[model samples]
Target chain A: MSENTTYREAVKRAIHKAMKEDERVFLMGEDVGRYGGSYAVSMGFLEEFGSERIIDTPLCESGFTGAGIGAAVNGMRPIVEIMTINFSFLALDQIINSASKLLYMSGGQFNVPIVIRMATGGGNQLGAQHSHSLEGWYAHVPGLKVLTPATVQDAYDMVGLALDHPDPILIFENSNLYNTKGELDTNATPLPIGKAKIHREGKDLTLLTYGVNLLKALKAHERLAKEGIDVEVIDLRSLRPLDDEAIMASVKKTHRVMIVDEGWKSGSISAEIMARINEQAFYELDAPMVRVCSAEVPFPYAEHLERAAMPQVDEIVAMAHKVMEES
Target chain B: MSEFIMPSLGADMESAVLMEWKIKEGDKVKKGDIIAEVETSKGVIEIEIFEDGIVEKLLVEPETECKVGTPLAIIHSVSERINISPAAKKRAKELGVDLEKLASQTKGTINLSQVEATDEKTETKAPTTDGMRQAIARAMSKSNTEIPHYYLSTSINMTAALKWLEELNSQRPIGERILPAALLIHAIVLALKKVPQLNGFWQNDTQEIISEINPGIAIALRKGGLITPAILNTQEMNLNETMHSLDDLITRTRTGKLKGGEMTQQTITITNLGDLGIESVFGVIYPPQVAIVGIGNIMDVPWAENDMLCARKVVKVTLAGDHRATDGRIGAQFLDKLDKILQKPEELL
Candidate 1:
């Protein structure tokens, strides 16, 4: 079935399919059952999958998320959904202390096959607490596999892939992408989580990034190509075990890099990428590495300020020009 | 299925000696599995396959020399059939022709150009060999015979450098001791910036200046001959970083655990004969790369300063460059910069 759906809908379909395929698979989150999910991702999931599989919890993110992990440790595949990334901070103790470290701390005996999904990024003028991108923070933890499903296709397939992996995986979904529609081939296969995908191929500069920033980078790449500045855009679908091989290979050919992330610049995922490039392919670069990141400030309340606070296509293009220049 | 050809380890290496086989005929092998060990002019290298297959036949015996691009076994792979010409493969790719489409029309070898010409088919054969040493032999011979090489040597005052190294190492633990070669490498990297023309490759009748200064460091193996694997991006590294990297590189090179890029990514070379007690050496430029910087053992030499002759520790530096890419003037500038760098070896740290 050739289908076109929003990113959030694709996510719902994946959860439904996973639950149908396996008896032990279940989803638990705030408003996921009777309330049909905060974002309406699981609108009818409660009726079809029933309360046993589609669980609705109170406002305690820590309590429900911990229950999901405990269930996962006991051989049940639990998909924990956080209403928003801001609330994931409330359960940071459970996610960091137990979910991520269980396998290593337990001598590889307890492989936490838990998938945590959360709405991330800023666009809806939600207050600072609700409108922040914190996927970069999760990527720092060693035992967790962090993912960003930018496209509808990725949103559709990555959930299943993450569920199949014998490790804890945190998928950060951009709140802005929930309404973005794209074609999803019904027969599409799951891509390996650790590998990156090249959205565009060029030879002059490589735009390394993930999540919804991929679209802005692609647009910038196309604009750059018009001026004969071929820009290669790589979507780093995997965050924790960053695909350095793909990043380095692109940098080797391009001789320049521009990392665009929704996170803050200092100590951000972009910083990690620049450090990796410095360690692996510092000599391959002809110019200094550049980062197009969200401004290091609390999410602004005003729309204009919000637009100015985040990474845009023009900023990426300008940064590309700056780094790709001959000194 | 998949033909495990002799890998081109280095730009200069064309073949290797099939010293031993870890897996014989009928043994199943997986990707990244060490199937054989081959000794090149550099050293014995453990060869790993990139595909899973069953060893159908052992094409060449152990200890036999072979050439570059020579295959070593007829492995019945879980993958598709081999022997598809690259040109035909490209054509097939352009037309979206896959293995399934060709399997019905052809048998054995599949060549797009010859498909309609005849029903003639080519047999699958793996031409295995001990070609690494031979490859190096052929490359170096070609470089010596065809390329116009110009050599330049200079005596550098290493008094301050040696003194600096001794003082720096005295404060650190013995395991963290820095070698003199690190200083030399640092100085050469800085010199390369000033004299950039000689620090790259001469390819396809053109001269290209490489941005990063990855120095191919010659490491002597236990058996004989030597392999010059690259220590990448030396320009950005500090003297301390250089020292640590050199330690790791030398250790890995001797252990035959060299990364693939290390073997093939030399933009220029650094040959230090100081450890072997050589006073000076006029070394060869590793092919593809255009230049090499050589350092000799430091010795006490008489120096004249302020009209007084005093004994100073001095080391000889030699530059071997491809004359086609650069002239003696460029080589002289590099040596001059090197000498100046050595005077302030403290800055390298």
Candidate 2:
């Protein structure tokens, strides 16, 4: 049985299922209890699980994130939520140095089985202070698993899988994707952490993306199909430990690649993926690898500027045309 | 210093025995200078250097057969030890400044003032066109002196071929139309494919049949001399592609833009003297190649078809083959195949 639900409800149900199954599981973050999550993801959770299980902390990201990591180390499974990725910088040291390195530093005696979820990306007219996407930064850190769930099914499955992981895991939810609706199987099995999914099969070119940009890429694929330009769309569900096998296989078949990234172009994840493709599958490419990344400037407050700053479907379609036209 | 490796002269040329060196160590060489002679399956070819340099070391001894890409010598660039500003470099090129002489006179960076002083002091050289004629004289004399040649001629009826080509060209624009020369080259390629023995080199007391057919087209330059640069891999081209390549090759050859591989990679040569109103020609086979096909003027000649004497457009075709590699029978077979192909010119398309 499958249920049609938004990404927010799918995540809320995954967390509720975890809390019901595991006594060690508890939710902790600012306004997670009384506020029912800053995005209303935990509505009615406090009333059902009570104050002890659905606990909310003061406005301090580093303090509560550190407490959650410490609790996980002491045999408690805690899901820590940050209101936005822009504020996650306040807990960068705790997440990178403490939570990520604790198991290796303790000689595998203590494991930081903590899960941190942060709302990321811009498109909601949120100013630069609230709308930065820092998932690429977290992915650069070793010893930490990074997951970006774009679809509702992945949102539900990835959360359930991240809680079962022994090491620290971070799930970056694109802020604009919470309202996007898709089908979620009631008994959906958890997807493997580092495997990518091919949403469409094509022979002309491969379009790689994740998070909210995946939707735009799909729309661009539809537009390109009308013009006889067949495109393959792949969602890189995991940022760290990228699926090189899947990426190379698509490159071998299509012979062209266009990466769509919401992050800035310079030193971004898209650059890293291009470097990897050049290193491993250089001869398979017929045309140079192209990327459509966000503008280097910070997120603009105006809706028009924000839309222009981010990579859009039209830009993706135009870039696909340019790539196809090349050898 | 950069190593000068043995280049693959043709598609089938894998290795070459170093026969002689035209330059020794400490010799200053300019680009396009014949620095060495290497003997491959196609006979001794004069190898040209592509950079202005001084010979630093000789790596391969004469008579040593080395594989392609084996370093034969090391050449140290003349300008490597000297620093010249961008403006000075441009001025030197315009003045044809002798960098070696300028380097001997100065130290540190060579600037525009030094270039101007050198240009004023040195005598400017006059342009000469006799060098190409002299090179052709040496190569043709070598071919006449070394190889025993045998010649044969046949008359091919071009009435059908010309009519077919005229109809085909009528449908296309002027620039995209095919010419009779392209059809002739295509027919020769097809004939070579049928009688493969004549489409190769006469080397080392035997005939070496090359896998790919590269026919050198003898195109006369506008000035006084002529060059025969091979249309590489003619076997793969159709009539239209053959026409395009022939046009491109002629333009580049006249402009002195032919590449080194085109100069040394001919399996056979084709010389057409028809445009000059010559009734017949017995061409000298370019050395190392076994045969040369010559096309003469197409004229209205008396023909007896089905015992009826009538006028027909016919062309005089001649083949000169190396007596050592092939015989009169092979040349006759090739000419026959070529005549049959021209009878159905649409097959070339």
Interface RMSD, all candidates in order, equals 17.0, 18.1
In angstroms, how far off is A46's CA in candidate 2? 0.3
- CAPRI-wise, candidate 2 is incorrect
Model 2, runs deviating above 4 Å: B1-349
Candidate 2 per-residue lDDT, tens place, A212-316, comes to 999999999999999999999999999997999999999878878999999998888999999999899875666678999999998899989999999999999
Candidate topping TM-score: 2
For residue A327, give model 2's deviation from the true position in Å: 1.4
DockQ for every prediction shown: 0.01, 0.01
Instruction: Please report, as a residue range, the 10-residue window in candidate 1 chain A with the lowest summed lDDT.
Output: A318-327
TM-score of 1: 0.49
lDDT per prediction?
A: 0.85, 0.89
| Per-chain TM-score of candidate 2, chain B | 0.66
Candidate 1 lDDT over residue span A1-327, tens digit each: 768888888998888888999998999998899989888899998899789999989899999999999999999999999998999999999999999999989998998999999999997888677788889999999889899999999998999999898889999999888988999865877678888999899988889989999989988988999999888999999898899999999987776788999999988889999999989986566566789988888989899999999999999989988865531
